[model samples]
Target: MIQLLFILLMIQIAFILILSFANPLRKLVVKGLDLLKQGRGPLVTKTVAATMCVVLSSTVYTITKIQKRSKDAGIVNPTDEVLMARRLLEAAFLGFSLFLGLVIDRQHYYIREINLLRKNMETAKKTKSQRLLKEMSGN
Candidate 1:
């Protein structure tokens, strides 16, 4: 269990590092989530969060009861290993959900920025063309 937790933590750290950088993989991930989020992003996020909460609480409760029973039977629950495992798993899921939310928000911001840039470019082009036409007619 400890080994599994260590491996999971390592993977999570690596993932966060990768996300911190500006890379094609990050862009792809953000773009994919953005596509999925189109109109129902909030609903999806909320649903996932609620589900995680339910699962985490239930798992914790079960582990705690098992540990208590084992202690009553004059045995240690392996240093609370099961509880630790459950909490670690819950943390991982929460972290992933948070990362997903942040990515979706960033993608939305990028999309808005792109649209704004396009509009500005089009306006500039139109004005330049109008100015050129006026100059030609003036001549």
Candidate 2:
């Protein structure tokens, strides 16, 4: 369990590092979530679903390879400790993927909803302006 938690912590740190960078991936994840909250197009919302997968797989592979290289290494996961850690990583990645998929599915719908809200706000502003103009003219 501790090992799994450590793995998760490492993965979380990597994610944080990625987010801290001023890169396209960071923008995509942050901006995508924003658009999603604004009810933008689901298609436009490219959630980082694939990201966790690629990261987790590569990380697990590297870790496993490292463990295999040491001849002094006793039995790896012989008592399910490593297996449990693997399961934790797997669960975290799988759950993240599903959640992103669901959220991104509404990407297009969100876009349309945001557009409608903008249109409404603009119309309201124009109507208020026209009303003010009429009042001034009458005075």
Candidate 3:
């Protein structure tokens, strides 16, 4: 499970890096994201995120319970110590994955907005130039 979460976190980080730059690949990535958000894509993504959140909460609960047990016993068993450490690592990875996912989503959204603005600006410039040409010719 930790390995899986680590892989997911790495993928998210890579996606964020890809989205941070203006390059040919960035356009492809943005297009892919656009398609991913269509139809059932959003529902699946939200479901997965919600499931991860639940698992994270459960891990936290387990960690707290382990700590309480150790406190009550006045000593931490070696096995409990190892288990707590593992759980903490898992929680950290899960949290980072979720955060990076949100960052990637936002980056994709902004990139799309920037692209739209560029298109609108180009269109406006063309129209303005056309108007200037008509006025000059008429005069």
Candidate 4:
């Protein structure tokens, strides 16, 4: 579980880095993301995210239960201490991965919007230039 979470976090970080720059790879990554958002891709992504949330919740619940038991006994056993630490690590990784996923999504969306606006601006410039040339020649 720890390994999986670590790998996911790394992948998300790399993806964000790729999206942060203006490069050929960024275009490719954005195009790939566009395809991923189409069809059943979104459904699968949401399902996986939901599953991670459920698991994270369960880990937190377990940690609380362990803490309560220790408080009632007035002492923490070694086994319970180790288990609690592991659960905490898992929760932290899960939370971070989820948050980064959201950030990546938002960044991708804004990049797409920026590209669209740039295209529109260029088209308008060209049209205006053509109209000015016609007016100047007619006058």
Please state the error at residue 47 of candidate 1 in Å. Answer: 2.0
> RMSD for each model, in Å, please?
5.8, 10.3, 0.7, 0.7
Q: Which 10 consecutive residues of model 1 have the lowest summed lDDT? A: 1-10
* TM-scores, each model vs. reference: 0.49, 0.36, 0.98, 0.97
Q: List the candidate numbers ranked by lDDT, top first.
A: 4, 3, 1, 2
Task: Name the candidate, 2 or 4, with the larger TM-score value.
Answer: 4
lDDT tens string, model 1, 18-133? 55667777666556656766789768877966876676567667667766777788866665676666666765565555565566466557755876899999999999999999
Per candidate, the number of residue pairs that clash is 0, 11, 0, 0
Candidate 2 vs. true structure, TM-score: 0.36
User: Candidate 3, clashing residue pairs?
Assistant: none
Candidates, ranked, TM-score: 3, 4, 1, 2
Instruction: Candidate 1: give the clashing pairs.
Output: none
* Distance from true location, Cα of 43 in model 1, Å: 2.5
Model 4 per-residue lDDT tens digits across residues 10-115: 9999999999988789999999999999999999999999999999999999999999999999988999999999999999999999999999999999999999
For 22-125, candidate 3 gives per-residue lDDT tens digits of 77789889989999999999999999999999999999999999999999999879999999999999999999989999999999999899999999999999
